[model samples]
Target: MSGSREWLCYTDGSAKPGTGAPGGWGFVVKPPSGSAGPAREGYGKATGTLAKIMEYRAVAEALEVLPERAQAVVFSDNQSLVESLEKKLESWRASGFRNVDPLVVESVRLIDRAMNDKELVVRFQWVRSHNGNPGNERADQLAAQGAREAKADLAVTTKRR
Candidate 1:
């Protein structure tokens, strides 16, 4: 990938308003040619997961699917996540993902995976949520869809067993 070209990804996560609810994450990647790559999403059954964890998971998922030699910038509405990825990730790794708070450590696996991809150049950018940004809005909608689907799936599973 040319250093001058960059792909953009917008990521978001959603869950029920209260804790211990199903959560979901989604990301939309736009390549340098101004066309969108596939939008990816997933729902998780894990209860009591923080929204921040979901947010990081969205970023991780996006990073995982990016082309190996691509230059990319990921946009997120979560400031802490942006800070952690860009600033604290190195220190967190130095401690082998132990010294960090358990919440931050939840994203360690994804973060480590991203770091290991030497050919992928990725950067994190913060965007205002619920703003007029089209990419962010779509990502948020996708996440909500994922959360709802997850809850419905869980309900169906419970009914069968």
Candidate 2:
């Protein structure tokens, strides 16, 4: 693919109804060719983790799966995540990741990974959640499924013991 082409990616993260619950994140990638690609989702032990972290994880996971040297615009429903990536990333780096209020240091690692990828040109776009956006809705569903799967996996493992 030409480096000039841009891909579109929609990403979302979901946690269960309570704090310290398991959560999941997912992304849907649309290549420049205008064909939708496979969606990616993951489950993790999200106990004590913030939803923002999961949101950032979704973006990072999407970037990781894209082809090297791909240019893409990633759409996210999390305003904080979008703002951090678009506005706060440089300041956070200059501060050496310190003394920042309303900043998530946990997401910095993944954000840094995405930013440092010389092969990828990634931009973030914020979309309203559950606002009848097809991509965002699909991403949300995938994330929920991932969370459920994670819980189920934990249950199975416990039974095995």
Candidate 3:
């Protein structure tokens, strides 16, 4: 691993575009050198049937599990979520995050905790989806599985991604 900051996290979420259809979120955190114990993956179901919410949930869940004080980049297919994390955070926070999704609020809070409380450096970046990116693809699969199963296994990990 390169120093103590050896993590990159990719996240994605899925939801049927309809009311009450259920949503799923997933994330994969891996070391750049692939030398860590193993890539950690997390997936879970959400009650809302909105991809945006699921996307936010995925990031929130991801930030929750990251190693304390580690520098990492979080990549996502959802541009809005990525922007929210990077660009629009202060404006939203100044307004008390009014009208923001609860999931998003939690995510921003986690980001703050990671930086201020945990001494971590978290950066956000956008990624194009379905372009055969291994980390994103695996997260997509886990999100799909969560959606199909309608499960709530948040923050849990399996051996492989």
Candidate 4:
């Protein structure tokens, strides 16, 4: 393991539409080699709200924001999400994600894009949430904040539009 580095990435999403708006997604990346870059954070909003979609979006956003040449291993609390991305993607897509929620498709697209990027080698794993993993906790908080911001921005944007 000497001179080898791995990146630990965590992502989360929130869908609280009770405020009369859709929710958002968020993600945070921590480098195992050492702290690096500006530390990334991102958010995206959608018409309806679902934690799965938001979670998928957050991971996608993180992948996009990560340095192109960096090698990474993403840790998520969602077992289904990880398994789908790491293994079941092709079958799911072929089956039209049958019996699967639309969010699963959206998430797969994001993962595919990330993997197809010219310079990314990503492996995903499942981590237990709220167990006090600092990086995961940070990512979770950032995700919640992103959701709130997205809802607020959506309201503002909708009003203006």
Candidate 5:
């Protein structure tokens, strides 16, 4: 239960596009390697958000639950998200996050905060959506459910460590 840790994570986001559209995000965080514990999950739904922003939020929140210094491998179905996290983050920050979509900037700030403040090391990986990957599928299901929850006027649900 104590040592360098690794977490297998997955995330996905759903939205119909356009402003004020129902959007949602979900994430799964498996137990650290060599440990035995229930997987952690969370989902959030809201209007006026985009799928990309939702995806960023999903990863951000999921990363927040990992213990400090834990190594995280985060799998996502969104290429733009993966690229932004892995490649564009530094450049985006160099510009002070100016000229970026406000929501997206906010989401990225959360992600950076989660990583820096928590001292977590994260690796972003892009996975093909609906390719029969169980974690990806599960996250997708949760995201779809979140999107539907927007219709039911539900709030975000999460269990943090």
Candidate 6:
């Protein structure tokens, strides 16, 4: 809401088989500040034990890929993911991941990178999924795509990681 404008981001993360099987996560960035409505589409996936973290990492990585801007807000359907990324992560990390989700720890590192960037104003908001919101719908599509791709490649990456 400052000078010209900034980016409005929507992101989503998913785990295949409801957290058992490998899954993927993705995010869609809509830059309303510029003439183009969609700034970028980003997706990342990982299989095996780190499936959930991989999805969350995709969001943080997408932000890293965003164009330099003065302001931006990120929206997601996962409240715990948002809260863990924005806060609570530090305490969990300080405790040595004790009772902390590993994915949460990885997300913390990514969020920390953003924190150091002064020009960026990133806010994480929780939105209701499948609510008929276009942005969310788009994000969901991207996420699904990412997950499917990751699942297909899980066998290859599982042993490497």
Best by TM-score: 5
Candidate 6 lDDT trough over 10 residues, lowest sum: 46-55
Top-lDDT structure, candidate number? 5
- Per-model TM against the reference: 0.83, 0.78, 0.80, 0.77, 0.85, 0.75
lDDT of 2 at 146: 69
- State, as a TM-score between 0 and 1, how close model 3 is to the true structure: 0.80
Looking at model 1, residue 152 earns an lDDT score of: 78
Off by over 4 Å in 5: 1-4, 17-20, 154-161
Against the true structure, candidate 6 reaches a TM-score of 0.75
Q: Report how far residue 69 has shifted in candidate 2, in Å.
A: 2.6
Model 2 C-alpha lDDT per residue in residues 26-100, reported as the tens digit of each score: 888777864556544443434444567677778877777777777888899998788878887778778877844
| Clashing pairs for predicted structure model 3, backbone only | none
lDDT ranking, high to low: 5, 3, 1, 2, 4, 6
Considering TM-score, which of the candidate structures 1 and 2 is the better prediction for this target?
1
Q: What is the clash count for each candidate, in the order shown? A: 1, 0, 0, 0, 0, 0
The C-alpha stretches of model 1 lying farther than 4 A from their native spots are 1-4, 18-20, 34-47, 157-161
Residue 147 shift from truth in candidate 4, angstroms:
2.2
lDDT score, candidate 5: 0.82
- Cα lDDT of model 4 overall? 0.72
lDDT of 1 at 123: 82
Once fitted onto the true fold, the runs of candidate 4 whose alpha carbons sit more than 4 angstroms away are 1-4, 17-21, 35-38, 90-100, 153-161
lDDT of 4 by residue, 1-161 (tens): 22247666788777775654466676777665655555566566664677788788778878886777677888788787888778876676577667456655666766766766746778888889999987678778877776777777778877997
TM-score of 1: 0.83
- Give the alpha carbon lDDT tens digit for every residue of 30-145 in model 1: 76774555544433434456577778778877777777777888899999788878897778778888877677476666756775764677788999999999989988887777
| Residue clash pairs of candidate 5 | none
lDDT of 6 at 102: 52
- The CA lDDT at 156 in model 3 is 31
